[model samples]
Target: MVSLIIFSILSLDTILNVPELKNAHYGICFLDLKNDSIIYDYNSEKLFVPASNMKIITTAASFYFLGKEFRYKTNFYLRGTIKDRKLYGDIILQGGGDPYFNLENLERFADKIISMGINEITGGLLIIDDYFTDERLPAGWSWHYLDAKYAPEISALSFNKNVVSVRMRPTNAGELANVYIYPSTGYVKLINRMTTTTNSENIIIYRKPEENTIIVDGMINIKNARDIDVAVKDPAMFAGEYLKERLNARNIKVSNPVARIRTYELFLRQKQPVLIDSVLSPNLLEIIKETNTESENLYAEILLKTLGAYRYKEGSFNAGLNAVKEFLNICRVDTQNISLWDGSGLSKHNLISPAVLIAVLKFIYNSNLYYDFYNSLPQPGKGTLKARFNGFSDTLRAKTGALQASSCLSGYIKINGQDYAFSMLFNNFVCPIKKIMQIQERIIRAFYEEMRRTNVDNTELLKPVEVIQQ
Candidate 1:
């Protein structure tokens, strides 16, 4: 049995010792959850960039700290009394850090306003977005990727995930492509320089820094229509503009433009605001599922800030980091082995060892929310794990992370009815991402085969024989 275990460890080593990964910094840890023992480990103590795999940590901590039934509430308040279908005071929209707030919700708010017998407002729409600090971007984020949909600015008042979809359809060859923006608002200006080509499509969309002008350049094949999601500059302002538009569409006239005020300013008013209605976001479990399975950077960041706001009455990144560290301490994970700069792994500064990830997984597994956390991860043929672990769909579940020169996969794998937690962290690799994924798949397959070959009587063989690397 001991020799068989040794052979399995040697086999994994052989699989990892490939030329493509020769220059890469990588770590692996596989633990038998039933036995509470490390089955195999190589460089598991060394820290490496985790990319979106950091969502795993953020989601787990959120599930533990914020109950599964937690929901964000965005409130609507009326500052003055209504008379003859006219509201003399402002209608305040108090943001509650709802990351999933969207245009549909805006419509609902409009309907609520109409139901309140208020058809006209004498004052402007006041937006209270001070639930979170004004730090829109997280620390250590790559500035060059700010225009991307995945790197949108964070805000307490977010609408449509703080992004807009630019759709381009090819026209006659050599002609510029037809451009359209979703929601069709006048909030952004589009500069289209994209031409229709006879060859493959190559489209580049960029939003000017601190501005709403988007430049759409490159070429699109005549047969393809491309839809690119670009991040917005000021998310609160974007939401405000759309809300104002929606109100006008509903025939609710506003005397002034939409205005923003801090929470303190709202409280300083002589006449207190009257709560009219509120919109509630989906429960936290649903949000966590989306955050982990979709690898949503915005949702993770919002969850982080929410923790800070809930625990310390502050919603800054520093407060969020402190909250995450406190949660890690609660899980008994060693703080020295981890460096987390942001909740989303979009920041390149995040570093964690495979052993630390395994520790987090183990802690969640033993907790009451284990099943909730487990089901939140992506599985084979689903979410980020789509097209992965082809033959083990029912037995394998994981989260994948990828960035320039970094790739990682971590989660649970069941073999012969026994569950195991595993993490594979690879960073600074010069090889193509496809090559790294292939290596990871091969290693997982090798371990699966080895574990399947062992019988119930040989279950002890799955226990730790030795640590392959310190």
Candidate 2:
């Protein structure tokens, strides 16, 4: 039999409603999913910056509206006439906001063009990207993240996630490092000032705003292990250039040798290009796993823009948010307290209460899409949580978010065979984020230990003890 002191350790009051957490600047809401009763609540109504926790709401809308089999299609249009196996017109590449459009996909696209029996292009490649609005970066995104790999420009036709990977290694102990860029493009200029040393590797790259030049300023250890990924300025152009090179390698000559986006007004007024081929992306279930498990900001934004385009016939950020609002209204989640500016919650302007998250979670639980929705969230021993929450209850499935001093976790946990929706938010903590995560894990462990102590195996004693009283 478990010791009775477990009771002293198990009380919800001792764990959550306490003094130390009073200064934690956090909000929490726990609800019994089966009974629809509040199990624990502390300032759940108060709002705070949600960081990437906003992904939870965006994800919910994605699955609900976008469906499980949704796939983004990028169209290839030929604008020139083919005579004597030679094309004399521009090739228009159209993007539909596919988030996983990597280098492999670009190579495939290039190969498809080669297979069409066209060997030369007299005109340059013109990309039509009117599917999304003119906005590249969301409003209120901090300038610090502007140059970061995680905060690349969101575009309907972005390639390689709009990131350039640079790898540098020292030739000798005291020599300068050798640098390399993927896709072998000269669009980005790399300034190598890093010196090789036995010292620890601290080499870094900083992008100059509004410029394609990046400065490498630091000392690098001889054993440079990892590659550096930095945000690119113009994703559509970068991708176009990459495709142009691929076409050249395959013996397809692109005369201008440059890839640029077509003007929105010109694209609308120009005649439609000849349809060559269209590439369809992977299914949405896979996308959901990528978005929720890996917490991909780009995928979330793409889904948001897609939702807006589907509903309002425009892929603007405002249209996407309005579509999300419409879905929230359908779910009866009050929108009065919710303020969301970006789908990925990269912007600190996003403010949402724990109660709102819990409500949406409960609403999903009642729907037929529960299995797909449940499996999409990162479990304790899976996805982003593979290294985190190890050996913890597998029943814990949730989304994690962080930005500067703000952090959040929200999801469902099963205790004593009863499902419960929970959200925990912490803001402005000066301590290390690892410590904050430790606290969150400790609270979850407490909940698990408490449920285990009162766990009953006998069907006759299943009066639900704690639940019966409620």
Candidate 3:
């Protein structure tokens, strides 16, 4: 009995004295599912800016509402008649905002079109992108992001998420040459004379597009640039132009020059979307893994917008937010203190508390999707958290959130061989970000050390004791 009493006192002290956690503007909470325990909690209920941790809530709602098996589809339909392999009318390409559409897929589509045997078209190409209810971009999305490839505007009739790729290569003796686009689309015409000096970081920039112009600026290492193809702006136009070029290569001729044509009708000659090839993405389970482990902005955006498109009966950002709200209400998550403006948590207005986050995790754990949900998080000391707790065991699995003045870590931890769910968030800290990171690391390490000294047998009595009375 004496040992029990002493251990209890020590555990309580350790819980309250978590390093760098005291009086923090942020909040931290720990819940042990195995024993129904709240091992340690400080300001767990206090509201704080959660940053990308916001992805946790958005992703959970998305998984619940969007279903795991859902795959976005882009369709090609023709309105006019096809006579003797010749399209007498216009061909229509309808978009369903497939975020994963790529050049390869587009080319396969073109190949299918070529296989149809119609070499000439009397009418032009028409595109319909009105799948979503709204055309205005997400509120508070930075203008700078408009031009950046990752934050490409959400479009229902999206092709390659409305992005293109331009590459540069260096040849022998300090001269640079034009690089080839994988699915060469003439939507963008390159006039780059920029050269890269040896032993220097390559510079590349995207110029603002003119009324039908996509410009690329900057220099790239000829060798390194050849490795990976980055996303470009205006993927639809690029894709359309590329298809035109490939058709021309096959002796197919278009009556009109390639241009952006926004029409709901498709030329009858190209009504059939012949399936030339198909590329399946990593499953929803795998996608969530990439988002959590790599904190990929692109994936998060895709999933969020995907959620919006699925819910609210429309595939727009507002629709997605409506779906999120409905899912939270259904799950009984407390949203009084939560506010979100974007799915990626890139917006500063997004805010959440440690308690709310833990609540979300707990709710998901108890839900029917528990298995797929749990596996989506990074393995402790492995994926995102690999470098986090250096000295601690590889038992911490959590989502990390980072911004200029904000840092957050929330998820589950297995302390002293005992499993626990936890959340630690810091925001508006005046201290240097380096120091805050140091504090964050120390706090995680302390949880393990404290758990090691406590008795797993008496975890019940110690559960509620961790949450201090406000």
- Maximum-lDDT candidate: 1
Superposed model 3: Cα runs more than 4 Å off: 1-24, 134-136, 170-183, 189-193, 198-204, 209-234, 257-283, 380-394, 415-418, 430-438, 453-470
All models: lDDT?
Answer: 0.88, 0.79, 0.64
**Candidate 1 error regions (>4 Å):** 1-8, 456-470
> After superposing candidate 2, which stretches have Cα over 4 Å from the reference?
1-12, 16-22, 257-272, 455-470
Cα-based lDDT at residue 397, candidate 3: 68
Error of 3 at 242 (Å): 3.4
lDDT tens digits, residues 157-237, model 3? Answer: 556646555555665436654554444555655555556545554565454643333343445554555423344554555
Better-scoring candidate (lDDT), 1 or 3: 1
Which consecutive 10 residues in model 2 have the weakest lDDT in total? 461-470
All candidates: TM-score: 0.94, 0.90, 0.79
lDDT of 1 at 44: 82
Indicate which candidate wins on TM-score.
Answer: 1
Per-residue CA lDDT of candidate 2, range 393-418, in tens? 46789899988888799999876687
lDDT of 1 by residue, 97-157 (tens): 9998998888888888889888899988989888999999999998899999999999999
